[model samples]
Target: MRPVPKQRRGVTPRARLRVLQLPVVLWLTLVWVALWGELSAANVVFGLVVSIVVCLVFPLPTLPMDLHIRPLRLVWLVLRFLGDVVVASVEVAWITLRFWREPRNAVIEVDLETSSDFVLTVVAEMVSLVPGSLVVEARRSTHTLFLHVLDARDTAGVDKMRSQVYALERRVVRALGTETQRLPEGGTP
Candidate 1:
């Protein structure tokens, strides 16, 4: 008699964990708590069925390295994002209010240092979320950011905006990006 070998699924344990690295936090889990109220036999059955259907219909996107996250980093990222939204909203609101006579608007160019596309995107989205400025275009190949500012005084204002983009890039890296060692590292950011 010959023994048969069992089929092996290709998923590695580490890889699987990495794929689901980030937990959705209580903001999402609270949905389950909604089922707790007004529980009769029919209500409970309906709630369970609805929850299952809802989750099945609109599942979260599965990501690689999503499950392999550091909690401290996640906490910091959320806090930073919240703070950015508040500060940026306020700055944009003020910019929107002022009555400036020759609005010298200009497209600001920003060079990124990081190689990660995800980090760059986060930076761009964060910048565009503000009112006075919007990302006109981002050339990922060149790591360049073209932002249209509400107004620009001169070269200095453009330079300042560019610097802000660079700083934003660094923050995104710190938040959700992994550092990559550039080989033959000799290029401007």
Candidate 2:
């Protein structure tokens, strides 16, 4: 007879590690080091202890996260995001230089395809990083963002802004979102 697999009790080692939020802990430690403006064994140890204490005191919020890191897609996303930043910077600069042509600013709403808070946060941050737009409000419950857009003068301009935001959201999903968050019309996110 085939032996039955033993049942595991309590949390596994991986689960315990997840609870520690290693990436966040490491980032906090790095920030502490930078704040001190020095690097030493003692500093590293102290930073780590402080990081752990802070993490324990105020734990990271638990989101419905199922991360599947695709290295290639992540690289592409970074490159594309950088390109967008440069282009937007130049455009915004041009707009500033031509002050005579008053740019029409508007608050446009964008409804993202995914309800994942992680995806929403990433999208909002990414959009805000690019020039010519900033997220004025984010409604997690509705999975929507209200962006203050520069030069959105008309309905067509508003539509353009909406599409641009949607495109950014799609890229974010393909970069880090789960398989279940695929775009509509059989488009792989």
Candidate 3:
């Protein structure tokens, strides 16, 4: 008969599980608070309880996190995103005011360089948040985004839209992708 292996002392499986779940619980709690639009002791307590319950009920499969944040790059990404939003908002307003003429729109596909799901999602969300363009579909398998662009009148306009998407993807990858996912400065990966 073989001898049984001894379990480690002090750290129980339940405790290990709680450690693994902490980040998700905290993120959920923060979202809950944001949705409620208020922060109070009671709200925090309730949110924590709800988050814990949700995590326990719907346990998510743990995937290896590929995010590696670069503070300077992240700042650049935010500033550029804000600038894009402002410019896009103005352009969209102009387009809306010109009701006499129908704006030419096109659906363009952009293939992103980074393979990271997190970077892809962030880029898609940022693109969608801009007023003149919307991400109609995202293909994770191909790392591709299909965007509906306003005022894309010709092939040149469509190419511009695709390049813009590529630039956004590059910025996002620079900000939050793993080292391998990041392209060299002024060049593709």
Candidate 4:
């Protein structure tokens, strides 16, 4: 009889791979359900299967992340994001209505304090989701985001947008930052 190989301790590579793929799979499934506009058992099962196939076909490189979730801060971040959306929507509507004037849009570069790619991606997505701004380019090397902002006519407007990006970044870091990540020197807005 052949001797049995000793079982490895801790997580096996396959288990680790599954754990890493879980988030992407779940997110893809959620997106599928959302796109269908209804949640049914069949939809969920199909979505899961499709997501799994997609993940297998185009596997993503996993990053070593030290994510820490603070639920209260996350709720606050969502509320703040919603408020920003409302305010930005009104601003954009007003800008559109003013037919006599050309809206002054500027592409500004914001150097984010956190170097984490996860944080950078979240911040960029949030900024892009708001009505008055969009993330045009992200520089991973410098941890910089270039956003095209509507109605940023002057230096003060540019500064305000820059500060707003920082504030959003601060909120993101507070909500989902790694254990060792430190908030910038100022108190949260």
Best by TM-score: 2
- For this target, which candidate reaches the highest lDDT against the unseen true structure? 4
lDDT minimum window of 10 residues, candidate 2: 1-10
TM-score of each: 0.55, 0.80, 0.78, 0.78
Q: Candidate 4 versus the native: TM-score?
A: 0.78
Ranking of all candidate structures by their TM-score, best first: 2, 3, 4, 1
Clash pairs detected, candidate 3:
none
Deviation in angstroms for 23 in model 1?
10
Off by over 4 Å in 2: 1-20, 34-39, 186-189
For model 2, state the Cα shift of residue 143 in Å. 0.5
Mind giving the per-residue lDDT tens digits that candidate 4 earns over 31-125?
Answer: 99999999999999999999988876565556667778989999999999999999999999999999999988999999998878788888999
* Candidate 1 lDDT: 0.62
lDDT of 4: 0.85
User: Looking at candidate 1, what is the lDDT of residue 107?
Assistant: 83
- Regions of candidate 1 where Cα sits further than 4 Å from its true position: 1-70, 100-102, 180-189
How big is the positional error of residue 60 in model 3, measured in Å on the Cα after superposition? 3.3
Candidate 2 or 4, higher TM-score?
Answer: 2
What is the per-residue lDDT of model 3 for residues 1-189, given as tens digits with 9 covering 90 to 100? 224334335657684475447888999999999999999999899999999888766655554567778899899999989999999899999999998999999998888877776778788999999888888888878788999999998999999888888887787777775644356567542
Better of 1 and 4 by lDDT: 4
lDDT of 2 by residue, 2-116 (tens): 2433423464666545557777789999999999999988888999999888876565545668888778888988999899999999999999999689999999888888878
Which stretches in model 3 have alpha-carbon errors above 4 Å?
A: 1-20, 30-45, 179-189
- Residue 93 deviation, candidate 2, in Å? 0.8
Error of 1 at 154 (Å): 2.1
